[model samples]
Target: MPRAVNARATVTLLAVCWCVVPPRLAGDFNPYGINSAYWNSPSVNAAYRAMGVGTARVLLDWALAEPADGGYDWSAWDTALVHCSSHGFAVSLAVCGVPAWAIRVPGRELSYAPEAFAEFVCAALNRARTLAPGIVQSFEWHEEPTHAWADGIPPLHGTEQRDPSQYFVAILTTTYRAVKQAFPEVTVVMDGIRGAFHHVDDLYQLGCGPYFDAINIHQYQPHAPGCDDPSGMHLFHFPTLLTYLRFMANRWGDDKPVWVTQYSWTTSGWGWGDIGEDRKAAYMEYVTDVSRRLGFVHRVFPELGVSSSTAGAGSAAVVYDDGNYVPGPASLSVVTTAYLRLKVCAQAYPVWTGIPEPVPLLPAASRACAVVNGGFESGAAGWSGAFSVDASTRFTGAFSARVEGDGGYVESARFAVEGGRLYEVKARVKVDAPAPSSAAVWMELFYSSAPGHLGYVMPENYYGVVDTRQYPGGWRRVCWPYFSAPGAYEAFLKFSLQGEGTFRLDDVTVRP
Candidate 1:
């Protein structure tokens, strides 16, 4: 990505959306974190608290952690972790970077033993125990292994080279073995990849699924004010990352939550100069709300840090220079205005968008359909996933469940399954906005007696995206009639509304 020099871009495009209310989104504010070189001190951390952010991504800088020639020195990290903990912040540590003792070539990772690296990682978490016990939330593998400088996995260096995928899994496998043995619950993240397309495919194919709890992507979008349409063509758009990452996760059955460990609309001297200070701020607010609705993006961190000697970070720094602690405006500068705007959004974000996992919202239905409160007249009593009960919208009753932004596979209560029995699943769906992906009505099978969920069957008419135009009434009936459930067990209905759109479903019925 080249630097956009002398561009001095204008900002009116994104400013229009400044007043739009955040809709009833599919997900809520996940733990917002930041990777910053400057916000390392206790005083600066108050800035994070002002943003209502409670997590900070701290790189367990190896050189900073270990002393010269002997044992570990925990003080460098202690300063940051202790203050963060005091502010009720959880520290997520990333293990990457070079130590001064290394004799290897620069830009490439030092060829160190995996066990040694794992040991170092464990040591960091253990130290955090004393400063802020159990405050460490996740252990990240090489921050961005796709690149040379960002990679922590040691390069083969003159030896017979390993396949890049093999190298990635090897590091993950080694780290997983040691990290889990130490702290089983702490999420171990994959090497935060820079360019994901071909690289992510190799990781899954090489059986790297079981190693990490979350997938990490370092999203460096080439431009800014381009986040509204996550479906937009420009690839590195952060929300676009959410869309592709979800597909890959489902495709390989590696449905782990995605954390964008690093992202920024580069105001650096790089070609990204198309982004102005105000535009950068607007883009941050845009991606934060829009990406959360995708249902899979659990955490997003706007990266902070670039050498002062190098190209300037422009306005990407939410807080920079000093350790000043102010969430509100003392004086109205461009940076402070942006910070205050973001703070409002953060404060307004409703619930914790729990990591997208199968929620068993099981309570038998009032009727034979086995869907409890299917019309949502009784409100959000039985349904699980993101949606709200709106009295204004209904198919048959006084209310319907309103879902927005790629409503991830909303599931119903379990219904009894009989062998060779065909069932009909029907629901009235209303799409208020355009959605390009197919809406699926499917079943998830599970045995009440023995083994659990046996995966979802293919959608009845999954290939084509739902067309709301043909149905003039606005509310269209979607049906999968005569769909059979083979073998013995119980089943549940799931409606997956894909793509970025506002939709509602009510009057759901199931018949055998």
Candidate 2:
């Protein structure tokens, strides 16, 4: 039995849970995967590898698998599953598109009888189990139940008294029970909810909560400003998404994971607004960082493969099907880099038979050269400008330097340095709550000119970039190693915060 919880209590509980829970409890960070429909082309393996995702979604279409009662054909699906396994990618299968024979009205609609569909699902699960063994980790009930048809067949809500969504609850529970009975270890996820929260309420009203392991959602946010068709919708933004997460925790227990099966910002000329390519890349990376920090969304699969047949002129795919589906800037800058970072961070990220696990987060203390009260333990000694010891959050020791106000900079007292020598500067940082998309943290290395005038050299660009956006809400170690320019004698460190968010810095250090 489930206990009743109000929205406020749920959010409070979740907050407490997040504060106390070990940071790495949810160690399984599923890579950004592609939809099975998009990945079934001839160039799937190369595209999948190029995307650098460790998991592949293999959709098992009930319509194709069992054309008739007691009839089965597994050739194409078997081959696809084998290919994914051969490439060392885990598989998540979604069984959808009911066969006409199982439909009560005998139409090409999703309105199929519950008992009959459940039988078909059990048989398919049995076959997949035999074919792939333990490689298939998850089974999704359907593609998108609310928006099942493309040509306006309308979703399956039979009547006011006899809700079609209630029937879906029946199918989900029945199929879930059978799948569990057959394979207790496999994970069962709800059909990716495509419509609204009311439909979810409908399922909950029918007492259909115990059937699945996790909830799957396909949420697409619009492109940022600079796009011809910028999305004005706020539902896809981070704050709204957090509200939805709290709602789910209230409705379906916070322990169950939420998997975002499809997420991306479309390019211009698509039915959605025309967002430019660079903004698309930025949004993709931003959304990825937000989801990871939230910690509940276990998997994030951005739409990578754009199909010429279905996709518009400005397809959102990082790799297109045409010209042998070449990888683009979004693939390298966003998807590939995101995957490598996730692999390095996730505690349970699997290493293949021969591949070695990533090295652990290196300890920064031993390598750091002493700076006056660098850890902020001595209450901001030898520091200047709008900085104070923050006891609430610290990377090491009892306190850290907290910087408030937008565009405010903090500087360390001048430290001796040698010209033309390589040195490393690092800081452990995290954005204070209410972190806006525009909020950023940065650092600069200061030096003296020939005339003894103080000048600063930003390692790479005009403003040295310390990617606070990429940091996962919690404390993260960021380091920059650079060569001191010739004639640079003395040096100092400068840190600043920009936008409407607070930032905490600890263990600020420089070393040879």
Q: What is the lDDT of candidate 1?
A: 0.56
In TM-score terms, candidate 1 sits at 0.56
Each candidate structure's count of clashing pairs? 5, 3
Candidate 1, poorest ten consecutive residues by summed lDDT = 11-20
Please report, in order, the local distance difference test score of every candidate based on alpha carbons: 0.56, 0.57
Q: Report how far residue 293 has shifted in candidate 1, in Å.
A: 0.5
Model 1 residue 506 distance off true place after TM-score fit, in angstroms: 47
Candidate 1 lDDT, tens digit per residue, 1-512? Answer: 11122222211112011011111234444557777664344445666676777678887677667645347877768877866777787878887764655424343353555566777788788788767888998888876555433244222221111223314455578879998998887978777776533345445555666777777877665433543233343333344344444445554544466777876664545554445556656767766665455445677777663223212445456654423333234321223434565677777773456433221111222234466877887887778776777788677879887776654556676766553343445577776644222232223333343366464554321222243433435565544333233453566666665555667788887653
Q: What TM-score goes with each of the models?
A: 0.56, 0.55
Cand. 2 TM to true fold = 0.55
Clashing pairs in 2: 229-273, 229-274, 268-274
State the local distance difference test value for candidate 2: 0.57
